[model samples]
Target: MDIRLNQLTMQFEEMTAVDRMTTTINNGELVSLLGPSGCGKSTTLMLLSGLYKPTSGEIFFGDKNVTRLDAEKRKIGMVFQNYALYPHLSVLKNIMFPLRMQKVPKKEARERAIEMAALVRIDHLLKRKPAQLSGGQQQRVAIARALVKKPKLLLLDEPLSNLDARLRLEMREEIRRIQQEVGITAVFVTHDQEEALSISDRVMLMNAGSIQQDSTPQQMYKKPVNEFVASFLGNPPINLMTVERMEARQYKLENSAQMVLLPERLNHERVRVGVRPEDLYLTDKDSGLLSGKVLHIETIGRDTMIRLKIGNTSVRALVDPKHQLQTGDICTLGADRDNIHYFDCDTGERVNVEKEAQGDADTADVEEYA
Candidate 1:
């Protein structure tokens, strides 16, 4: 079931919830619509499910246009944030509800429901009421119900949000496995960056009613389309430093002595230098691009999170726990030439590395670090 949204726009009064969004969700691939709250991810999902008709544009489930289809007419199985199970009905009956409504014979519906329950690993819990099951179990029941009718497409709205940390981890794996086993085209909406990265085959990052970037989780993190995409996807966040080009291959932090030998050629005189926290390491002042005083430290597992104050700006880096450092101690940070990212100051677009004699600037001259 390949889903396509062709210039889909959903406007309500003065607000446009889904701006002319056009993209295709490939058959049997699970993609996640990821963004912050009010970014219109949920609204886009609604448009796809036929819950809201677009103000313009078209939607297709395979080659068939479903732009005017009613919600019930579209074969979309939706698993909501809340389980949305019946309190009085047992799991078996709840899972059979959809098939029953379609006038499926009682015997066939019962068998289908039982098979779905087994698929989601909840077959034994079929006799239990919704209130009798744990949060994870209830979620499994919801997933089973959605699949029992053999929906061509499945939409999960923050399916694991209500679970505990451990349960969330467990279900993330389960969802991916079950989705593969069912071989259905699936789309899930979530604000959790890590969750989207781990679970989906691809992620469509949304912002202000438009798709920002659509790519694999690895590419989205390694090579973000823009600064916002880079910042939004990281946990501690990528460190941003304002820099100005001094000359060829020479860039300096704005109004500071922190100089760097940028590996890429820049068309703009002013640009932003982005370096991930994990890419930096502690080094002597002579070999470092920037120097600062240690302001804060936190130990997360074996990795140590260190915040440094450089002039008026604060920079953060993650290091090994073996490096003993106290507050107020002077420190310097160094990054590999390939790890640094450069973006245009005004447009906020990445510098085109392919346009230049790449790596000519990376040949480290000792004086450049001074």
Candidate 2:
């Protein structure tokens, strides 16, 4: 089932939680509503589930308008962030509870419940209550309960937030697998960018009660629509340097300590250059694009993150763990020209320098093929 929200708005006395949001989610697609807290993601989910009627606008389940639908009538399976499970009921009974509520026969409900329990790999714990199960197991039970109903749409509201970091990773994969296996149209709401990026088929990034960008995870990260989208998607975040345009292709840092030649067209006298942490590579101090003193070092598994102080600005670079570096060590950093971003200083919007370069690359490839 495909879901469509047209100009969906939710007003709260003096404030608007969701502001003229319009988007389409394809059938059987696991779309994630990703943003910071109070960004209207959860509110949108509620509206879609028919818990709150939109102040204005229409909603459609496929081609049928469901704007006036009620929660109980939507036939939607919802999983909350808290994993709301009945502590008194055994896993089997808890999974069957939804079916029982619909007046399903006892034998049929039990059989379906067992099938769901096995689907989530929690069949062995059918006899255990919520209090006796581990956090991950309990979460699976909650998921099984939601799925046993076989609703056309599945809604998850930060369902993995309660789990540990490791468990969160495990459950995300489990959720993806289950969603695919069931072929149910799923909408997952999460404030964690990594969670959304890792699990969703596409991400609808929201902020300040508005949809910022709706695209695939790779596109969201590689080609963010604005400064906020660029800065919000990455783990360590993209490093931004304020630069004053010196000429058509030249720019100087805010501290006036270094000048750079971008070789890209620009229409403004001031711009901000965005470089992902991974794009900043270690190089000789005299030959690199940026140079600074290493202020901090963090080694996690295969990659090392180094925090460097460049003039008055702080920049972080992700480098190989094998390359040894310590605090107070002077290091030089260079960015991949193809990966660098140019944003309008006044508007905080990407300038598309990278895309232009990509176009030129494509043109070259086509010419060579010809």
Pick the lDDT winner. Answer: 2
Tens digit of per-residue lDDT, candidate 2, span 1-370: 7888999999988889999999999999999999999999999999999999999999999899999999888889999888899988999999999999999999999999999999999999999889998889988999999999999899999999999999999999999999999999999999999899888878899998899988777777777778999999897889998888788777788885777767565666888889999988998865578887899999866889999987789999899887778899988888777678878888888787533333211222221221
Q: Which residue ranges in model 1 land beyond 4 Å of their true spot? A: 354-370
TM-score for each prediction?
Answer: 0.93, 0.92
Error of 2 at 101 (Å): 2.2
Q: Write the per-residue lDDT of candidate 1 for residues 1-370, one digit (tens) a residue.
A: 7889999898999999889999999999999999999889998888888888899999999999999999889988989888999889999999999999999999999999999999999999989999999999999999999888888899998898899999999998998899999999999999999999888888899999999888777767766777778779886889988877788878778766777667554556788888889989999877787788899999988799999987667888999889989999998899986677777778776665555434323323322321
Compared with the true structure, the alpha-carbon lDDT of candidate 2 equals: 0.87
- Candidate 2: list runs displaced more than 4 Å: 285-287, 322-326, 354-370
